[model samples]
Target: MEPSPLGSVDKALLTLDALGRAGADGTSLAALSTEVGANKSTLHRTLAALRHRGYAEQSADGTYRLGPAVLGLASAFLAEENLPALLRPALDALSAEVDELVHLGVLAGQEVVYLEKVEPRRAVRVWSAVGRRRPAATTALGRALLAAGPLSAGPLSAGPDGGTPETEAALAAYTAPGTTTDRLRAAVDEARRTGVATETEENEPGIACAAVAVLRAGRPLAAVSITAPVERMTGPARDARISALRELLPTVLPAGLAVPPAP
Candidate 1:
């Protein structure tokens, strides 16, 4: 004989699934009872348990729906997964289509950490590796993230000493001599206006890059970039690369990952 299902747990899960399918309008108790194949009294007890735990909610019309606890579960799940693994397919496809290197990065303090990299079959390739760190103010990936969100909470903001030493250090480390805070701010503004960020021989010599931030719920979660030789990243070629990114990235991104709207 087959092992029996955990009756209460199974009923609760079925109810949650049904409520999710019911959408924003929710479902009535009778409908849920019919859907889950449980008696009204039994299902009501399950729903009460769910509600006590903040997992299900009953509206004024007596309809049941998913509650805030579902979002908390999703957030916790995402937080535990390896981000690079989750985004690898999109980066692979992008690299193949653009015939260049693609990178996935996330901001950490004043630096951007390279979490993943996908390279095309080209002989001349950018020299980069996973786990590498770069200053956020000069790289395309970092700039894209900065442009997508506010700077007040990060190193860009003035410190208690009333000086932006961290910001200055980031720029000095990755940018050319004499590059100023105003210039970096201008680049970020340009990125916000165009829906992408660019750097031509700024972060790495003889290299150019263009990047866009990956967002979730209007907040920047990470950034993706295409990198190529400086020659292939200018004029018509550069426009074509950026266009490919804007058109193709959204199609491959996993659920909950989105590209910000273009200005």
Candidate 2:
């Protein structure tokens, strides 16, 4: 059956999504109109409604961004769900065992938003924060989420030539050799097969991460990762960290969770 036409409210939501993809710099009215393919006058009215309810905000220079209302909604959801209450013990255990930084994150559109950070004392410091967003194609956590998702076993070769500028930079920034597209494809394929993904100095210089998805009933709930400095993550150390994660996955995930059949 054909989908129904979008209502006024739905159009406004489409505008909202475009605004989010614009990021911290915000989006101009003309760009938003172009993005949504709506007439300028109609988009103006839609944005006006969003602005009136605090769901969107126009800056002094006429760029729009998500407003406080979205943050309020996110805060309420996080508080009510209390994810830390359910996962802190596992995070703490992993952080203590590995003596490094552990993170829990979930996919938000094409980015992964960090939900929590467990930092081991005296570990190499990093700038990752509780709400920071990182591109999914570059980070271990994001790759794990994508691998466990419906796109499992899919190829990344069909994108625009050389990928995005940001993606190109990440793909080229690996410390050691072998950051080729073939290597990335093999890693992602392995992640889909094993539920684990690894990234080395791709997201940030001097850091390496290994991640595994936290699944409930065969659906990805979030991704958990252990990150350490490059020096501390080489050879034997890297193998041990990966081993520790594999050993802990069943323990951390809820017991008796259903495993869905492959499509």
Candidate 3:
């Protein structure tokens, strides 16, 4: 007989809770099974599915960790949860001013997962999502969040969307065609200094974007970004977009949601 699904597979999804507790270090099968209150065999299959599609990974030491793929799903879920819902109207207003696509994203491992998107009227607009994923080291939205994270946070790590690049090439290189890893590092530093980040055709040729991070209780919760066509992205105009995003930062982050967990 086919097995039943777990706990309606919604807000109470045990895997998310497990991953949250495990943090970046990941957890062993035995440990996660205990945390989720599920049998080892059942959790193994669930984890296998998560692993098969890149939502989870088994480290060399044999522990299971959240994979890059899960970021897309989690961001989508979180944005719809409560906080982002309140910010949607404001994000929509920003989209109106930009006359291009706008998106809200959050850093997940080495990338930003699109949490919300305000599409332009045109059929030729950049087609991504409220759930699509982009590399943190390569995309403006990701950089914005990374730059705004606590000073103790480390640089972006490797993820699955692109694959397992070697340490040298991944750290010292730029996966985006026209950029370098050093340049990305510099951009992150700049964003930290100025409170925002921007990109010109780095993610996609002829596409330009500006982003500002939303911080809550000293942690970066998300970033708001404006995307414009290359032709219209004048230098000062780009700066203006970044500036506008900064204005919304305080409103986007709530008073005490930063920790996402109780202390």
Candidate 4:
């Protein structure tokens, strides 16, 4: 017999993927042959090999489905994950230490996606669970990362506007009872002034958040945040959050990434 153009292992893998999309009622060999653009004989032999390996199963009615071996691959990947996972252990320990909720988010368009979170053991805590999405303009982490975009002159600076149309629009979104758009603009100004951002009841009432940007190659890759009940997040406590981050920020940075602005 002439050799099959579809290699044994490659052909089996392709057939497995096709069966998943085809679903349980099953599909015909001819249909799979057409879908994979392989001749009938080659495709049949591939499916037989898959059945023997237990990576793909055939139904009583002759349909195909994925097998249990895939779980081993998925489990292995999840075991040694990083960043969101690597940061979680540290964030969790911090949450217990601070009695607050901690989060790590990455900028996504005009919003930020909550990628990792650590919550307090106590019942009373700030909301916004892991995987919760929040608008960038009105949140502390968003403004922190945004403000890291520009440098500041002082605490409450000269102009409320940052000379950019985008900055002004972002500044206009802080309208949550205690927080005004002007204040948010000022807060961003202050973060640029002080190198971090903090907010109280800006997005959610009776909640407070402090965020510091993680810079990479002159860009903010993501932000780290700490959230707590408004009362617990005030005075010296809030100030400490900012102070500690500034001190420790250099440690997390890589060799070339730790450059401070030269006078």
Candidate 5:
């Protein structure tokens, strides 16, 4: 048998649960007492304790309701979650449906760091690994993230002195020999207009990719990309691959995460 819960803790939790069910209007002290099956005096003490800890609030009309602390705790829990672990199932299903390599990445300064990857059964695969970082300007994943709002200088920041333009210049110095700042800026703009980003051999030779941002509260929390050989990703086939990502990715995303709507 499970150990019995402590009386004080149990009472507090039961009161909280009751308040939650009571909704935004809150509940009267008498009603809460009846629901918890405790005497008015004991229930009052419990309510007082809950209020002291910020777990419950009393309205001007003397009704009790859930408090801001509950939301704070929820936000803290979400912040501590591991992104790769939370989204693995979705990544796996997407790779299976598209039969191509899928990558999950986050922006780190001007680069995108790969957090998770799912590979298909084909012998030919994109050369990528977890923890590897790539230029945000040259890769589809980074461009998708950049396209979503809330960059340090704002999305596709065009200020001459800083933001995307400055980052583009810095990226150009060390990126693949042929990649140019103008081309990278254009890719980001395209992503903003089209709601997806694409790269052709910009990150690696013979590789092509398409990506979409995973958004939270209107900001890009991460990005997902489908990578394949250049031949398989060009012409009409490229359109099909991109369509697959837009169509299939949303189906497997967990609650609280979403892809931008098609433009």
Candidate 6:
């Protein structure tokens, strides 16, 4: 019972993606046609339509690139999405108390999409940004989100690997001291049990974080985390951060976004 794909729309989006990858210099029609696998004429028509809508712009040299219209669309989307605005004040407050970076992220398939980032005054250079994505298994935010439920209907109706050799290789590739599949499984289980997730230098070396989901009726809508240098996150200080997150969740989350009582 699969639905039919919208071929033309797909092609148009692929063309835009190609242009984005091409960077500021833009791409010529010949290159775009080759990348999108379309005839030059059809691609021309598509590009013309996009240009008319202000989604694409042509440079003087006959190359095309993404236009300011894309920014407009993105702005509209973010405003309508509202998650960032909704969480900002709470995240800001949390960052102030902890004197560390606080980020809010949502689960997107196998990754977590960062929506907002609040950096303390003495923040480290974080590798993430607003709209960036990272693997769910490799972060406390991802583990916390997964603790609520899967993004789609599948296994773990009740909930959501550490490593074999294959997994070890994959984990090694992810980062040094990266998460193994088995370790990831263990983290998910722990989050389910405790309603919090923690990680040390998994994504970026020297960074550690503790996170918890903001749930809506037992499903995770998003997650929030406090991140700091590994040395700063330890003993009573780390415990205090976890305690603060648990205490703030009820007050920070709006009415509709309720965290179901722990089982």
Q: By lDDT, who's the top model here? A: 1
Q: Which runs of model 5 end up more than 4 angstroms from their true locations?
A: 1-81, 150-178
Candidate 6 residue runs with Cα over 4 Å from true position: 1-80, 151-178, 259-263
Model 3 Cα lDDT, one tens digit per residue, 1-263: 44456453531257766876687899998998888887888788888877788877899998988889877865675453554685677677777765668888877777678878878675434668678887777787877776666322444433454324453354453335456765776777667667667787777778888777665556677778888887667777765665556554344444433312211
Which parts of model 4 are misplaced by more than 4 Å? 1-82, 150-181, 248-263
lDDT to native, each model: 0.83, 0.75, 0.68, 0.66, 0.81, 0.77
Deviating ranges (above 4 Å) for candidate 2: 1-80, 153-184, 256-263
lDDT of 5 by residue, 11-68 (tens): 8888999998999999999999999888889999999998998999999999999998
Q: In candidate 2, residue 112 scores what lDDT?
A: 81
TM-score of each: 0.75, 0.56, 0.55, 0.55, 0.70, 0.58
Put down candidate 1 lDDT per residue, 74-94, tens digits, no spaces.
777555146788889999989
Would you list the clashing residue pairs of candidate 5? none
For candidate 6, the lDDT comes to: 0.77
- Encode model 2's per-residue lDDT on 1-263: one tens digit a residue: 55438678677988989988898799998999999888899999998989899989999999999888987865564451466566778888888888989998888776788889899987475778988888776788877877777445334442657555554444344312324555655566667766678888887789999888777646777788999998778899987888767886456554533222222
Q: How far is candidate 3 from the true structure (C-alpha RMSD, Å)?
A: 12.2
lDDT of 4 at 49: 76
Number of clashes recorded per candidate = 0, 0, 1, 0, 0, 6
By TM-score, highest first, what's the ranking? 1, 5, 6, 2, 4, 3
Which candidate number would show the highest TM-score if scored against the true structure? 1
Please give the distance, in angstroms, between residue 155's alpha carbon in candidate 1 and its true position after superposition.
18
Model 3 weakest 10-residue run by lDDT:
254-263
Between candidates 2 and 5, the lDDT winner: 5
